[model samples]
Target: MSVWEFFVWFFWFYIVISCISIFIRVIIDVFRDPELSGWAKALWLLFLVFLPFLGAFIYVIVRGRDMGRRGMTASREAEERIDDDIRSAATSTSAVSDIETAKRLLDSGAVTPAEYDALKAKALRGTA
Candidate 1:
């Protein structure tokens, strides 16, 4: 075959490969998304895998929610905020969780020894 014919075939082959790869990635992400109910998601994925190009195109247009980046970013930010809040609240709660509280409660007329010991056990257990 002529060199030009080989080059033309190579170019079309490259385009076909690129399109297939992009389609597969989109299909994978469509199934990876957490929004769809598990069974529906699984069936939709089956459709994509079995039906190829048409199913993939239709699935992205109908079911894919523009990839996961936006939702993932929002979830990550919320998780970080919750972690920060947990740390702040934990510091104050920790002060009340030490042996000092247990000892003080025991010495005072408030908690009996059994109650103090139980509370101490709970505090230590919780800390661990």
Candidate 2:
């Protein structure tokens, strides 16, 4: 075989591999995607199988932003949860300190009745 023949075969092989990889990735995304419902997943799979290139490209364009938003939402939620847990643990571990702080804040009118109740409960209970 000539060098041109080898080059053509290599190019064809590369193209096929790329298409297969794209298809697999798209399928996985469709399945694992939280935003997509069961019907949407089915439709996306149908489109991908029938109109592979167009379907994949459209999905990437449409759902890509949602994926980014989901990531941000998850990160923010995780941060908030960690902060809450730390606050709870700290209040429990430092009950006397928390009560002193709450008392000072209440005396200064910086805390509301509900806030005072919650803080006092945590202080008395030594856990919440």
Candidate 3:
């Protein structure tokens, strides 16, 4: 093919691939959505399957705002979950260390049994 022809083909190929990727992403997102009912999901899937390009184009045009919102919501939720997990792990490790230190003090006679109990309770409460 001539250089010009090759460039035109490449441009078209890029556009087609981009459209297909968007379509697949939307389909996956539709199924992942908690707000979409099973029937609604099924109808959307049917439309997409039967009408590929038109359906994808229309879906993006119609639901584009909501699609963006849902994507942001999912991303925020995932980030929050990861943050919670990290905080839980850090808190647990700190609590364990605090309790261990208290136990060592009690064993070495630096702290009384009552003092050790209080420290343990404080550490546990701090974690919670």
Model number with the top lDDT: 3
Ranking by lDDT: 3, 2, 1
Give the clash count for each candidate: 0, 0, 0
TM-score of 3: 0.71
TM-score of each model, in listed order: 0.46, 0.51, 0.71
Lowest-sum lDDT 10-residue window in model 1: 62-71
- Model 2: residue 124 alpha-carbon error in angstroms: 36
> 18-107, model 2: which lDDT tens digit per residue?
989878877876776776799999999999989999998898798877756665777799999999999987755577778889989998
lDDT of 1 at 95: 32
Query: What shift in Å separates residue 124 of candidate 3 from its native position after superposition?
Result: 12
Q: What is the C-alpha lDDT of each candidate?
A: 0.76, 0.84, 0.90
User: How high is the lDDT of residue 113 in model 3?
Assistant: 99
Q: lDDT by residue for model 1 over 1-128, one digit each (tens)?
A: 99999999999999899879867777667656767688877787787778877777787676556665745766799999999999898765663557788888789868998998888888777777
Q: Write the per-residue lDDT of candidate 3 for residues 17-116, one digit (tens) a residue.
A: 9988988988987887788899999999999999988888888898888889888998999999999999987756678999999999999999999999
Candidate 3 local lDDT, residue 55: 83
Q: State the TM-score for model 1.
A: 0.46
Mark the 10 consecutive residues where model 3 has the least summed lDDT: 87-96
Runs in model 2 lying further than 4 Å from the true structure: 65-128
